[model samples]
Target: MTGYDDKPWLAAYPPGRPPHLRRAFSTALDMFDAAVRSAPDAAAIHYFDRSLRWAEVDRAAEAVASLLIARGFAPGDRLALCLQNNPAFVVGLVAAWKAGGTAVSLSPMSTEADLARSFAAFTPSALLVLDDLYVDRIRPILDTGDTGVAVVVTTSGLDGQTEDDPRIFADVDRRRPADTVDLAALVDAHLPGPGVLAALAQRRVGPSDVAVLAATSGTTGPAKGAQLTHANLAFSAQVYLDWSGLAPGEPVLGLAPVFHVTGLVGGVCLAMIAASPLVLTHRFEPAVIAAAAARRRPVFCAAVITAYIALADSPDVDAADLASLRLRYSGGAPIDPDVADRLEERLGGYIHNIYGQTETTSPSHAVPPGTRAPIDPDSGVLSVGVPVFDTVVRVIDDDGADLPVGEIGELVTTGPQVIPGYWHDPVATADAFIGGALRTGDVGFMDADGWFYVVDRKKDQINAAGYKVWPSEVERLLAGHPDVEEAAVIGIPDEYRGETVKAFVVPRPGSTLDVDAVIAYCRANLTAYKYPREVEMVAALPRTATGKVLRRALR
Candidate 1:
């Protein structure tokens, strides 16, 4: 018997909300099929000035699926997709599933080393890369002849968009690689013939089949892949739909990166489940997103708090441009109550807090639509809302004993949305999931009324603009430099971004370390968000008697 057994949060559920899902699709593919069947002519994707109907998307996915199978992409094979929030990403995701392959989500911002580490962790059989990314990142890897990737399909970010906004697309390379197959050409072929349909029919995807290998923060080590099955994706999508009460045919704004779990499930899968149009602006350019919102009149958007802060601060974006957003949810990082209030005042919508991890597929806790999240009086931290449908959240002590209400401890959760295990890593899987519940390294507590508030992390991980940036990873990268004797990284508060990476370094005996050069070195090696934005030259990092760096002391 634990404090969570009584389910105190149910009392606060929105009127007419069910404790469990009333209905859910067996898989994401099933959900996509249902949407196409219900609204063939409804807008499925709105990219820039172009809108692709449900039927159009279905046809394109089917054609691409056929092309994939013809290229020897077998069942259970993994298809690595490195792209931004574009129409092809949507088409490629459905196509991967339809062709009986697992979709591996890879960040477009990943550097060569980052990509190499990810590839080593999960070997993909086929790769769908954006043109510029192909030229800069993928081509070099292919030249090394190390990866098992057999089929290389490339596409341009300019595909399906009639108006190429110079803010995003002006520098985009539309050139197709001579060695790789063009995704646009495959869709143009429209080869979903009887043979292709028969192939798809033979390879039926079940709920238990892995849908996406979402990457997690390599806080302990290299970024591990959380194997989110079709069931996980389907249930998580339904939770978003029901918790938010997003109406059918309403446009869902795609402000988060599609490569991320938050954007994949909340933005893409949620839109598919609701039969809503997914409004995208290539990537998350605030001015462009504001313009799209004004034109499309999108009512729902689930993005990081940083994105909301940026959108609200953009001089080009006025309240009128964002007046259409009614269901705004922010997750991936802690939200400031003052920032939320000011954003609401400026944007005219409550910034509902949604909480989850890559292991949970997307969201396990979210503020109910039309309800305001409460702030913890003692800590002044805003609650991350209560557990969603069919979820059990409990706070436990170091020995795994259940903690009383309002006592800060590690948050352990078990839900339909939680992943079964990490892909190809049994040791991590065993360590993370204990007694059928995920031992989320997050430290938080649940109030008596069932509002949950996160206080800190059990690990030394930094959440910069909702992207996980581990200090160890940054420290290791810094230690690789010739001029650095030792380094330590920490996260510092930023007015706009929720947190930014800051590094403290010790120089070699005689070597002079230029601060700008050190920062530029990290910027060149690591992803934009992972690199340290601020660097300080220090004589030594505060350490304990055991010779371990005390990050809290540095903080």
Candidate 2:
């Protein structure tokens, strides 16, 4: 038996924080409906100079739902959303749920090949895509008639923006396909009326029904769609709202890409649960986000650590711009403590770390508000945080047996937030879900206090001279260097050592990095066998749309 079974982390929970949600909405639609009823006139989304109220958002979603239903979109169908962080994305998500269809979150940055892979996996019946995506990706796929798509709704990414930041919308193509249905026209054609709501009620989805097919980052392998039910999404949202102590009408800055699960739940779902205004800057343009934060006074924000670093480095941003952000958080990737500290110093807020995946809907473990996560003594890695509300996290060996506290193994989790399975991939699902617990391929361990530290991905461990070295540990150490802005490590083949450590270093602006000096820095701090033997200087490391490093690309 291990301390995980006793839930030692609860002892470290913030004052008055409950181990479980007292009450949760049955579905994401119920959560959104409650927000509309509680504050119909309150701003739900802020896009540049424009703001959409809760009622307005609901009406728009209802209109879109009506359009979908009219166009033969049926219950249990898949509605793929291929757009960036815009009002249309939110509207499309709610519309899919309202129409009793699962919303498939597709990244706007996805290439044609990437889109094709997802289409084959999910077989989406409909698509609400950005005009640019429609032109480049969807149209080509539609031409081939290989997809199951029947309904196509297109929107310019600039919808709902009264004032566009040139940095974001400059040189943007607002062109729409002449034959495609316009999302805005749909909203205008069907006003806020009881007819649509009445029609939607008959097709209402239950808690267990899949609400979203959140695509995995595909860092380790081919991306699969994680089937997140309405309950999973709603519960995850409640956990975030309660854990962050977000109050009604307090703005939540949208930093994470809404297409990503972290942004979907933390940015969109959390805002609905808290009845808070979700401030959006279209996409993550540092200058635009900084200005919006300054103007909107967003109280909470959760993004990848890189976004924080970008803001800290942005010349357009000042410390006062981010002063109103009290509950700042970073997720999607691990945070280097030095980077977190530097950002906090520049931005005037403590950056809390959150850990989750597409399968978890959003967060399974998050640092409680007002508390700082402790670093692991051995690995020098910052703790991701304690297991979130009602979640069970165990570090297990290959034999499915629990490892003792402080022993590194795969992290497996089970809770309301965990997904039921991967969409349409029974074999993969079976391999991932054992009994009922999700086997997170993350290599990590839980401590005496129940604090969890993720070393690296299990597949990412490097064996140098028969010694194990986690890239994250070495990357963290390299990132601590004053000259290094970012670093990524990989295992490279070496005849003598079997495999040697290689690091790709991104130098800070105006700072020159010496490869030898960088390797020496890691050598001085880390064990000889664990330090990088080869260092490559790069302007930037390849990353996913959600900011997770693409180590495979380096290899």
Candidate 3:
């Protein structure tokens, strides 16, 4: 932020400004430092009805960073952040960077076994956790392990102390005064000693050093941490900031956690770089988030499609304030057009489908309004946008052959935005990177205009009577039905057709749902081979941590 603020990467972004390529000070520490300078007293985070201003967050992060340095913890020490969305999470993130260490994200709700696996793979020097369920689960997991994890801190209950050792510090109220050892004071107290702050000012971390280790959010597999360098996070944050037309100091509604790339980069890190204010929610609640969205009058709100749908249906929805919102972004799962149409009508905002995964650091492509992909309602929903700036997207066959435009194939992506590889998972890493491109298991295609459309997965595609059908196409079609609350599609074996298209529909609380009626609706919208041959109603769809629906769980 100091030496290369004028670089190309930091150039005028948003509304399609060029990328910022800072040779110096691309580290997350400098980004947070700049935020502290730009909006020192503005609210940086608001969660659980508690707020922390930029100045406060900056000092807090600094204090935490200095604490690590004073303890002789040098740069590159991995710190596992296993807490939920809170001011402490941000404090820990910046603190790690300020101390020249990388913050590795751990899912808020990892099982004991999952935590153990992560600890062994990354071998982080410390683990920061919440006390109640999170820390409790992790403590037991470590008790069973032989690895020497040096630091363990709990933010869940920051009481002076009960009985924990090797803690960085206990929690203290940012407004309270006491010898109370909390993270804020920890960083501030350590900032001036041992030339740490001066070294921080110089900014040693950049494109080469790993900035974050984010876990994969794919369903049906063990999560793998993605080693993202400083350049990866910086480039991703810069691209999203530019393409979305978001302005500096814009108000961003934060729901995603630091554990996910989208949540961390777009939700937190982007806000830091732009000095944008944030309205926080510990966990997503449809009505709660909608009420806050209305009151906050945020510039941009990004989350999954379900959250958008819930906001539109919320009784407390203030369509007017939401109307002031510049853009609404959705990721995690493909957007149901019905949801998009409803949001446009209620909030007067474009329904943008941001295509991304944890591996890419967030999103690159977004389908803005006025660009509608062809509505097959049978084949699949077309992704109505081109690749993000400087990013390349391709469709390829199994053998890595380039498929002609408009033909279905595996979606492969390559760019500065793409992740290098999965951390410690050599086999998965090798299989994931095909021909220098990250092989997104997603099955999609590119149109003549170079727009990408996600159909289904190679694993999810259904073949019935030798005809290929995509589940997303049928699910989107049923989403338009009034009685259908939610839908998922899968395939079942059929004696006559070899395979038959099957649909799982979650209906309105009291609405009567019949497979015949739903199939009749798809019949009106889809081709003969694409229509669902069987339909079953369900209560809810299984979802992953990032809120992506798990279609594989279909009955």
Off by more than 4 A, model 2: 191-195, 510-512
List residue ranges in candidate 3 displaced over 4 A.
Answer: 1-25, 48-50, 70-74, 157-191, 194-203, 368-384, 493-498, 515-534
Clash list (residue pairs), candidate 1: none
lDDT for predicted candidate 2 compared with the true structure: 0.88
Give the per-residue lDDT digits (tens) of candidate 1, residues 443-552: 88999999998765677767887887767557767867889877888899988789999999999879878789899999998989989999999998774221236677
lDDT of 2 at 452: 93
| Structural RMSD, model 2 | 1.6
Error of 3 at 371 (Å): 6.1
What TM-score, computed on C-alpha atoms, does each candidate reach? 0.84, 0.97, 0.85
Residue 360 shift from truth in candidate 1, angstroms = 0.8
- Candidate lDDT values, in order: 0.86, 0.88, 0.70
Identify the leading candidate in terms of TM-score: 2
C-alpha lDDT of residue 306 in model 3: 69
- For residues 1-555, what per-residue lDDT tens digits would candidate 3 score against the true structure? 111112222222235344323332366666777888778999887653456799877777677665565555668888788876666788788777777888889887777878788888888876666655443576677667665566665564333222322222234222322212344335435535557568665445767688889878757466788988887777777766777778988888885655788778878888887788777655566555666677676787777776777677777666775665676777777665556677788867777777887787777566643345454443546463556666677778878877776677888887777877887788998988865578888888765555667776678888899998877778777877889888888889999989898888999889987888998898888889889888887788888777777765553
How big is the positional error of residue 50 in model 3, measured in Å on the Cα after superposition?
4.4
